[model samples]
Target: MNVLLLNPDALRGSDPAYPLGLAHIATAAMKAGHAAEGVDLFSENCPETAIFSTIESFQPDVVGLSVRNIDNQCMRAPIFYLETAKNLVHTVRKRFYGPIVVGGAGYSIFPREALDYLRADYGIQGEGERAFVMLLEALEANSKAFSFPGLTRRTADRVEWIPNVPLASLEGVWADRSLFPPLPYLDAGTRQFPVNIQTRRGCPMECIYCTNPWLEGKTMRFRGPEDVVLEIRSLSDNFGIARLTFVDSLFNHPTSYTETLVDAFLKARLELSWECTYNPRFHDPHLLSKMHDAGCVRVSIGNESGSNLSLTALKKGFEREHIERSVLDAKALGLETVCFLLIGAPGETKDTVLESVCFLDELNPSSVVVTLGIRLYPGLELSSIAAKEGMIDPRQSLLSPAFYLPRELEGWAESFFLDEVLPSHPNWTV
Candidate 1:
């Protein structure tokens, strides 16, 4: 079976992401003896004609759509982005007779709701590599697909989700790298750097706004440290790629595992610049100094909120003081540290936002980026909170942008940072 995987580049409130899940799904499909062609709508200019032409040429038996985000979380809202997605989906549907299956982080969270909203024939809820490939095999076999695992389908009356079994092992399948273009958005600081790798899956953190535990499941699975470093050596030595990013959800989740991996990188002396998110709790200044010696230049921290109350509300185990210490600690190691701040959560208020501002004043990170609250994600405590607080209309599709902040501080926090904090602190920007 030939599968055309569609990656729709919609607005994410977070980073401008690489399509990691789509690449993995393509890998799985190809490994199963099915030819998988990935068309990134972003790279393809979001045109119906280009998609139709590709479909006409490829003549695929399955169309798998990857949706990574639900809305434009940026303060600068691009008008009609959602409408564009709907139109593109509809246009693709008209040209292709194959079943449309939705997957990815955004779609994984609200699998049932998104499946209904998009009129998709099926949705893969959890990990797509296994579930999606399994479904493709079952569909080809003419078997009962509704009972296929980790699948969600809309029946006559209501949608039914086939629960995914727990993942018990980790397999390192070299991803189908051809689907991704050459690193297109490398920071100007390190454009000459070569190949990159995603060494792990799932995050152990239970931050309120995060969907890691639910979407990727509770376990933190990683490839062997030796294997990861070998891949890095191939990138730096053979591919002439000096910069690599480990796009892991929690790069430092298992303290022992990370220590071993960092040691592997040091032993290899790959001479590559790298950076990844690290938990402050596991961060020892000595360890960071070693990483810096091995060419690590920057560190990213998820000090999501500054208020202790907000931290407790969001279940960020660490406190304001921990963050403060972390900032000083990272700086002492000669590592440039950037704080990723989230202003709006359940206990968010004018005062809590002020606390974050004060934190910025004290730590004065090399950079800070702020995002407004996002409340539409399913399988989150925030989802229930939004519903209970009347922030989300029961009948309304939360698919469009929706958030939960203190009603009084609605526009103030986001505007204040853009107008005041970012301007005054040249280091900070959204």
Candidate 2:
């Protein structure tokens, strides 16, 4: 079987994320004796013609499209991305007659809807490496692959989704670096950001607004510490890529796993600098020290709010004190700390928003990223709350843009930040 994987993400606001998921699928499919190639649309000029030319040359038996994000996740200026995926599907169909398959972080969140909307023949929801290989095998056998876990299909009347079995082992699944273009050059100040690598999958945190639990499962699974170090070393040696960002939902969770990985990195003595999203609730001096020694240059704390009222309303496990300590402790360790805060949640108001701003002033991080409204996902608690509060119709498809912002705080949260807090605190941005 010949498979051509397509990465349709072109948004470069942040660093151009290496298509890690597509690379993994390509690796898995190739390992199973199938010819696989990954083409990043962002890296190529004339992407539309590139797709047609690749199809003409490769003549693949299957085309797999990876959708990284459904949207920008910005409530203020939301950019819906399913249309892009749909366009890619149409582009591939224009020249090729093959089974079109789709999967990725964005696709897994709403697999059935994405498949139907993109008009693809199939989609694998959760972990794509294993499920995708099985899909190829099933296709080769001319048997039904829809029953396989994490696979979805559409019929004339309905869409069917196969529940994925939780893959606990990270033994052989790895991202093939050669599938992507060489790492781009960055200046000294921003060079710390590099291509992303994942140490694990899944999240246990039950933040009300988060879709990580729905996307990656709730329980955490980790790659072996030595395996992580080995992959890092390979990246450094083969590609001269030293800096990386661990794109895990939460990096420092399950302290034992983090400690082992950090220890491995230290023992290997790799000249590396990295950053990760940290949940402040698990901040420990020993762990922080180990991470610093292991070349962790920065910590992006996922403390979404500075006010306890908002924290409780959002079901953030940690409180304001936890965030303060996490920031102060990371700063003390000489690790640059970046704090993320959400402005308008369920209980957000003038007083609570001010309280959060004041708290940020007290424990000043290296910088603060403030987002205005919470983007609502399909199965999250925030969507339920939105429907119950009459913010959106219950029958509405969240596939389009939907956000949870208090009606009372309408026309106030953005003004307050842009007018007062942003001016006083140069470190804060929306």
Candidate 3:
């Protein structure tokens, strides 16, 4: 079977993310005795032209599309990305008459909704390496036994979903980077465009607004430290890539694993600068110092809000002190710190917002990313709370952008941030 995987993410002004998930699926397909090719729509000036050309040339038996993000997640002037995907699917349909499968982080969040909306034949909910290969094999065999984990298909009346079983280990699974070369992605962006690498999967945190647990599962799965370092070495040696960003949901969780990984980087003598997100719950100065020594130049802290009220409301297990400690420690290590503030959570108020602004000002991070309202997803605690508070209808589909902001701050928050917070803080971006 020949499989053609397409990345349908072309968000403007955002960094072009390497389709690592599609690469992994392609690798899995090839390993399972199938020919696989990948086409990145973001790399082409005209995505429709690229899609038509690829389908005409590749003539794949099956086409797979990876949806990276549903939206830009910005409350103000939000950019919905699914329309582009729908257009791509229409284009693919015109060129080829084969089964189209959809998968990736964005689609996984709303498997049935996205699949039906895009009018794709099938969708994979969770990890795609094994499920995708199985899907291809089943398709090749012309078997109707599609009752497998993470696989979804829409029947006449309904969309059937099978719960996904995440891979227990990531030992032998490696992304086939050849399908989507690094040069195209590297040349498309600035020098700071870091190639993304995932050392682990899963997040155990109970952040109310996060989708990591649903997308990657709650169980922590780690790849061998040596294997990860070798991948980095190959990237550097083959592509002359020096910068990287870990896409792990919680990079510092299980402090022992993080320390060991940092040690591996030091032992390998890889002269590459990298950055990763840090959970304030695992803030450790000693480990951070080691990471800096291992060529870590920056750290991003997802401290949604600096106010304790907002933190508790969002179910962030850490408090204001923890956020302060994390930022201070990273700054003290001479590592650039990027702190995120998710404004307008459930219990947001003028006082809480002011507290967050003051706290961030005191911390003085290298960069501050401010998001106006919390984007609500189905089955999330925030979603339920929003419904209860009458912010959004309970039956409303979140496939379209819906956000939760306190009624008092609806028209006031954006103005306040734009007028006061952004002007005074030169490094802050919304």
Identify the leading candidate in terms of TM-score.
3
- Which candidate, 1 or 2, has the higher lDDT? 2
Judging by lDDT against the true structure, name the best candidate. 3
lDDT of 2 at 137: 90
Could you report the Cα RMSD, in angstroms, for every candidate shown?
3.1, 1.7, 1.4
> What C-alpha lDDT, on a 0 to 100 scale, does residue 44 get in candidate 3?
78
Q: Can you give the lDDT of residue 115 in candidate 2? A: 88
Evaluate all candidate structures by whole-model CA lDDT and list the values in order: 0.73, 0.85, 0.89
- Model 3: per-residue Cα lDDT over 10-121, one tens digit each: 5755778888888888888999999888888777788878877877888899999999889999889998898889888898999889899999999999999999998989
Instruction: State the RMSD for candidate 2.
Output: 1.7
Count of backbone clashes for each model? 1, 0, 0
Error of 1 at 289 (Å): 2.7
Model 2, 2-29: lDDT tens digits are: 8988987557555567788887888789
Ranking by TM-score: 3, 2, 1
lDDT of 1 by residue, 1-430 (tens): 9899876766433335557678778878888899878787655654676788889999988888887766565534533344555566797888898788887777776777777887788889887778888889888988863476688998778888877664555565445555754354344565663244777777777787777788777787778888777666655554466776677777766766777788888888777788877666566666667777777777888788788888888888788777887678778877788887776778788888888888777788888877766545655777778888888765665566666676877778768877877778888766
**Cα displacement (Å) at residue 400, model 2:** 0.4
